[model samples]
Target: MKAVIELNEIKRDFLVGDEVVHALRGVSFTINEGEFVTIMGASGSGKSTLLNILGCLDTPSEGVYLLDGNPVKKMSNNERAVLRNRKIGFIFQNYNLLPKTTALENVELPLMYNPDVSASERKKRAMVALESVGLKDRMMHTSNQMSGGQMQRVAIARALVNDSAVILADEATGNLDSRTSYEILALLQDLHRKGRTIIFVTHNPDFYDYCDRNIILRDGKVVEDNRNKVIKDARETLKTLPEED
Candidate 1:
């Protein structure tokens, strides 16, 4: 299988006054296509730094980083932006949807960056994404009008609107309740079952069971990278939750 993301001895450094802080120390890993991966770490473990590099939001200070076999370090800034927009979808913990915008409109925002998509096509794709997230009836609802979980669902729809190759979720369930967190995880599992490559970054160890692989980071380096032998079925777990009021 082809690797969706490949990192070779990746390193990142930040300057704090006269001192240099090493955010990532020669970390390396490959994420294969269609795999669900969780990157777990405590604060200052370099998970966020690694995520920025993976998302193409920031470049590494040293070593090669590849996305879909293309060397990210070699790409120009414009090229990187294009690649990010076309290939990567991001889901944030805060459900970064436009507060005043309708769910459908918010989902359609990403499509606006692609000149190849016409207005009608953008709307069509956005509607399909919303429907896939089971938010067909909430298309016209604004972000502030929806519950926390619903807002997150709309954010997921927005991420899927562009048909991105990989979904990068950064602490995606941090703000939700336990039951709602499982619901979101179950939705992510469903997406993974359909062959979407997902890279989730979270500090929660319990969520590791839902992933196919776990990569634990410590002090800016990979401490453990192992395949999860016993994966939890989020859908089944959801069934055991009490009825939502």
Candidate 2:
């Protein structure tokens, strides 16, 4: 299978004045196309940093990153921006919506950034994305009128509106209740089934049940990388087990 994301000897450093803080320490990985991956880690573990680089939101401080076989390290700011607009979708813990913008407009924002798409085409694509996220009826509703889960769905719609090949989500269900989170995960699973590539960063390791691969990071390094384990039916087995006597 062809790799959708390739990271080689990647590292990211942050500057607090002259002091350098290492966020990613020589991490390397390849994510195949159409795979759903969960990156698990705690604070300062570099999972978020890695997601930013993968999503093209930030350049790695050192090492190489290739997205769809294109050398991302060589892309200029404008080129990277364009690539992100077309090839990558981002879902955040915070919905990051324009509070005053209606759901339709929010989902349309990505298309608005791409000059290649016409206004009519944008609306059509946005509506399709909204439908995929099961938010078509709430298209005209603004953020203030929606709940946390609804806002997150709107965000997912906005992410998918650009017809991006890869989706990068950071704690996409952090603020929602268990039921809502499960609903969101089910939507993501359906997208994965439809051949969309997904890289999701989460503090909750349990989310691995929804993924095809799991990447575990700790203090800027990977401690475990597993497949098959991601789809294990442990929860189902646990439900049938005897409780403490």
Off by over 4 Å in 1: none
Q: Write the per-residue lDDT of candidate 1 for residues 95-203, one digit (tens) a residue.
A: 9998799999999988898899999999999999999899999999999899999999999988898988899999999999989999999999989999999999999
Each model's TM-score? Answer: 0.98, 0.91
Q: What pairs collide in candidate 1?
A: none
How many collisions per candidate?
Answer: 0, 0
lDDT of 2 at 130: 93
Residue lDDT tens for model 2, 1-245? 98989999999999999999999999999999999989998898988788888988789989999998988888899999999999999999988999888999999998998999999999999999999888879999989999888999999988888878799999998988766676678778878888999988888866777688889999999999988653744334345545534
Which of the numbered candidates is closest to the native, going by highest lDDT?
Answer: 1
10 residues in a row with least lDDT, candidate 1: 235-244
Model 2: runs farther than 4 Å from truth? 229-245
